[model samples]
Target: MKRQVIRSTTLVETLAGVDRQSRFQHRRAFTLMETLAALAILGMVVSSLSASLHLYWKYRSVSRSQITIAQLQRGIIEDLTSDLRMTLQDPVAVRAASMVAAARSESATEKAGSEQFLNVTEQVLELPTDLRNQPVHFIGTSQAMALLHEQRNPRFDQARSSYQSAGLSHIVWWVNSEGSIRLPLFHSGPQLITVAVNASKDRRGLVRKARKDSGGSASSTSDEDEWLVAADVTSLRLRYFDGENWRTEWNSFQQQALPLAVEVCVTIEGGPEQETPVVIWLPQASD
Candidate 1:
């Protein structure tokens, strides 16, 4: 009886030991192909996760930048349109015959009142080569001479005299090499105010900043130039609507007061063109 019991215990112990050895061999020995496949799967998962994170960050940055640019554009456009709608046509000329002397200095040439006068919101000045009855577009204000000269004749010599005799307003725009929009308002001959500042040639910016940062004590060359109706700008392009057609240029002068409507295109850098032009449909006033 004791020998039979001892033999059974030994047999059970031998079976348990064989089972442990088999499990250890199975875990320790794997084919090269099987190990490579496992590693490949792990690598694929890590790569996918990294790619997903990169794309998410990129999209987030673009979206944020787009929103900021849009907000600035909207604010500027709305203000311009509101002022234009209130603009009248061919009102009484404030003073048609106040002659301003032609400026000798290019800076002094583009003074207000020297070559242009405002009738309500309309400025009455002469053209260089006799426009006869051609339409006029006043794109900018002469801060240097704001309401001072109120006259212009594009041919007025800056070197000869401080007076151009006569001229309405002029429109000129150019995009610079460093991505700057340089728009100068020249009345007699010199540039008065510049829009979309030179970012670098910030003489204008400095003057403006002093006015803002110094609690309003900064002296400016053209202080009386007030901002009148302006084209709503988008992506550096401005479209003008003349009631009949959406125009990129102002061709004729029917003296219909302000433009019938103005179309502004907005395009941001590194993004798609804005599909909708900010159509500033002017509320026509009585002729």
Candidate 2:
């Protein structure tokens, strides 16, 4: 009986040892596999996060560029509208009156000379009539624009005071060869304002002469102030709306009065050829 009891205890110890060894081996295998799987999942998560961050930065840059362009467009439109409101017609009217007076003074030439003097007088009279009959406050083409209007001091600072004291200024907007928008304000100087007009066309789309040339001298030599309105201006188009229809060109010298509405289309770099332009109404100048 003592031998059987010792044998039974040894057998039980052996079986218990085998069971523990098998469980330990199984646990080790499971832990190694779990570690490798966890690492792979972590790598994938990190890769996805990196990709998301890259996309976010790219879109942010594009958004900033778009916003900047929009702000510039709005500024240009506002500046033009504000200046157009306070248009000065008295000067043009006075000039027309003077021309008529000059023509009348030459009336004696019709009897004193041949048809040449008579023809000159007739031509002078016709110009004064056209000026008196038609009020050309604004005139422009696709490339350039001239505004013969009085712009009030839009600022509330010391600059505004100076502008007010200096009186109204003639404003011109034109595009340069380098795709830059330039505005040259002729401070009550009509003669200088003519240099800003790109009314005629040569071999190119429009004749772009020196910005300012006083007798073949470079304009930069003078103290004339020119403001850089905006940059990267690919194109600028204007449309005038009569009560009936919209026209691409506005020749105030030909048209009787200002259009009922005006549309300004500006094309900037990295944008479409023609964007939705700003349209403004001018009921005051319509008549």
Candidate 3:
């Protein structure tokens, strides 16, 4: 009986040892392929995380740019509204004289037998041009516009001219081909104030030029006079309302008048071609 119990105990101990050895061998048998697969999975997870983070920052930057552009658009609308409200009538002897000059330049010099014939022909060719009575003129095209109206200088404390008391300043909003919008204000003292809105030259983003103050130049020769009001503009379009409908083009010289309402549309980079336009209603001549 003692021999039988000792044999059973030794057998049980041998089986347990064998089981431990088998478990160790199984652990050692793990293939390099499995390890590589695990590493690949980890690498993929890390790459995905990095890409997500990159996209998040990129989107955040784009959002900030859009917000800035919206703010700029709002400010422009406000400024334009104020100017249109104070729009002045045509100043005398300006538009009509310009038309006459243009006509005279375009008119062909007729061959005549005598000086008397030439004089008569000149008088007949001279159409009675009405003197311009208002200080406002609007010339618009599909891609650009020139808006000339009157507005009080918001920078009264920094007025260039001391004699400027009333809001009788001639404001000109000119849009160029390179998506630069220039606002030039001329006062009674013939003082000129110019600023550039959304100026982007050669896709360099916002190019800020030093503000120029060269007295009364309608168009500043110096680039330093350009004040950057906004950036990344794509296009600027203006339309005029003639009581009944809207016209894409407005020539004050041809119409010999100002429109009842004006619509201004501005396009920024990465934005739609047509934006919600700022509509300005003008008071009649009687008003």
TM-score of each: 0.45, 0.60, 0.54
Off by over 4 Å in 1: 1-23, 30-40, 92-200, 203-235, 251-256, 273-275
lDDT of 1 by residue, 1-287 (tens): 99999999999999999999998777667665689899999999999999999999998998987786677567646754544443333332212222221222332545664334333123335433432222123342212110112243222223234323233322222222244443322222121333343323422211111001011111222122112112222224555665576555432222324556666554545546654567777665332
Please rank every candidate by TM-score, starting with the best: 2, 3, 1
Q: How high is the lDDT of residue 192 in model 2?
A: 21
Query: Model 3 over residues 49-69: C-alpha lDDT tens digits?
Result: 999999999999989888987
> What lDDT does candidate 1 reach at residue 28?
65
Task: Name the candidate, 2 or 3, with the larger TM-score value.
Answer: 2
Q: Which numbered prediction scores highest in lDDT against the true structure?
A: 3
Question: Which of 1 and 2 is the better model by TM-score?
Answer: 2
Per-candidate Cα lDDT values, in order, are 0.40, 0.55, 0.56
Q: In terms of TM-score, how similar is model 2 to the real structure?
A: 0.60
Candidate with more favorable, higher TM-score: 1 or 3: 3
lDDT of 2 at 167: 33
User: Residue by residue across 1-287, what tens digits does model 2's lDDT show?
Assistant: 99999999999999999999999999999999999999999999999999999999998988888898888777777766765555554444345456555556776555764465557546543544222122235665656665654333343122222223233334456655533333332312222222333322212221122222233222332212244455566677787887899887665544535566778787778765659978878744211
